[model samples]
Target chain A: MNKSILTKREKEVFELIIENYTTTEIALKLKISEKTVRNHISNVMQKLGVKGRASAVVELLKLGELSI
Target chain B: MIKRRFIKKVLVTSAVLFAFLLMCLIPNNNVLEPTQQLEYVSSEVNKIPIYLLDSHNMLGRTNVAINSKEIDKQARELLEILIKEKGDNKLPSGFKAIIPSETVINSLTYKDGLIKVDFSSSLLDVSTENETKVIEAIVYTLTGIEGVNKIIIYVDGNILTKLPKSKINLPSTLDRSYGINRDYSITSYHDITSFNVYYLSKYNDVEYYVPVTKYVNDSRDKVEIIVEELKQGSYDNNLMSYLNYQTELEKVDYDKNEIALTFNEYIFSDADNREVLDEVISAISLSIADSYNVEEVVFNYKNEEIHKSVIKMLE
Candidate 1:
């Protein structure tokens, strides 16, 4: 998958999720609405065609879009 | 005769099909028109883009234009929004107030090209990492107004010669020369040349232009530096740049007070929306306009006119 295809905000949300931040924690840390945080997660998951947030993170890691 | 007529019909049909195919192949420039009103609505109060620092420490500008008619009121309102502690009105994701939470602008005055901004003592309580960004947020936001060039910051009627927590000394008057995106990686500070470049960042699904002032030891012209920097994309990992990574500057020419940049086709490839394209143009124009005393910026692709924007500086 093309890495540059994901937006800056999506990358930020994905990184936070990978770091084990909950949706509420991500919302608080990024200073955005909880709905917006959920939107980002769903958007990323949709883009990667993953069913769950965990699968999305796994796909991103497998694609080398995220690293430990 | 019948066969000739039938051949003519077939030729005409194929010609029409070829023409339709060609039309589909041509790139549509009209698709990039502004479809959404660029407004930041928070708490029933319409907030325009005031420059603010992101979590990764990059300056993101708002897409909304400055309300020139009521400069003072808008400035004060934006300042209030900037300093307000956690409120129902939320900032875009990954961005936060540069000014500390408890800080308040007690008074703001514009006189003789200088904006005397008096802030409450709470402004001094910023941490060390935020010391410069806080000062930048104030100066940049204030000087963005018409007729304001320099800023004199004060804490309760006293000039802030040094930051309260970090103790970083301040120049008596601060302006754009104070620079954004100050690179601490440089070893030889004197040889550094500063250039202001704009990158795109999205908040609440609306793309905003983020201006980053880069200091490099290279001595290239400011316009070339900007185009190159823009092509290199945002230094901040979390910030998105609208310019495609493959975009290449074909040529740069300065004539009759106008700076023109010719770039490759990749510049338009990533812009899926007209508003985004317009922001890309403004971001490039504003960055160049802020750094150079130029009247206009002309963007060209393949030696053909793509777009031209008049440089309207805040002051």
Candidate 2:
């Protein structure tokens, strides 16, 4: 049940993360504030329902949206 | 794939995609690039030696090279591919893969539960992070692939002479050595992928994950590797190690014409702090001038009783 819905902005964050981008860099790259970047990551994590950064990565990978 | 897949349809629409699809439907053994060159493709034929491939002409669509050069050519191609994959001639585009551009992959093999990867000494670099990153990148890359569990790295195809952090109990195999470093920049290390292996770095005697945050600003640069358990009753061994460590790290910052001499608490252990202080002075005596040519070496385990011999050498 793919209840997890990611906004286009959240999708951008997810893509950058799998490629090893830090929140600070993601903020700089997207021209957003660090707080907003962190918020998006937090919101994405809440939607995906994962606990840790690594866990969110694993779950997103499980959904096949990101590939190593 | 996302961008390329879409771009291929619109921009390349002028390139006869319908004709290409028809050709593909015809079951011909080739896919034309945008240049429209009919480059033949064959998976089975690629495995055959080139000499045999050259010897025959499409006699009922049979490949022709039938001689010794085929094997040699194929082997050469394999080497070229591996070299390119190494990306040392350039670099792994985004991440900090600390191994040098010229470093050669001497041998890469996998068997049983281990992947034994050997590289040239060029792989050796300065900074604790570089050593850790190269180790992590190589190990994870191999282990991430199917059928690999452990990795042992070799320099110039030989095991390291001295580990970055000298271990009390000798490692059981070549894989245990994390070769010596000579430089100080932390960017020498590469970005680690998944799987956290908390390898302890013996900074003095206390075994712990040497956090490199003091050296790098990249939040993802947190690297750790597993060090084996101490055989001599873990607690005591840890104490003695940290004690020895404390003394070893004490240094004189000659840069500011200043010195930071920390007395190892353990130097007060078997011998009085005085004797340890004498050794510290003697070691620092080797050199501690503010010329900027010589880097300052810290002493974390010396005695307070400084010897004239040490001061004289600094002159």
Cα deviation of B125, candidate 1, in Å: 1.8
lDDT digits (tens) for residues B216-254 of candidate 1:
545567777777777677656755556666777789888
Docking class of 1: incorrect
Docking class of 2: incorrect
Off by over 4 Å in 2: A1-68, B1-93, B126-128, B161-315
**What is the lDDT of every predicted structure here?**
0.69, 0.40
Tens-digit per-residue lDDT, A1-68, candidate 2: 22235677887887887666888998999999989988987987797787665666655543434433
Cα RMSD, each candidate: 22.9, 29.1
Q: Lowest lDDT 10-mer window, candidate 2 chain B?
A: B52-61
| Model 1 C-alpha lDDT per residue in residues A1-68, reported as the tens digit of each score | 12254678888887886565778988998999989998987888898897886566555543435533
Report the C-alpha lDDT of model 2 over B1-315, residue by residue, as the tens digit.
999989988767857887788877886676667864454545443322111000111000011222223433333332222232352232212212334556676776656767666677666643443444344334333432334456666677666433333211212232312221111223311232321121123333322221111121133312111011111112322111222442323333343433444544544434643444333342232222211123343344444433234222221
Superposed on all Cα atoms, model 2 deviates from the true structure by an RMSD in Å of 29.1
lDDT of 2 at B62: 11
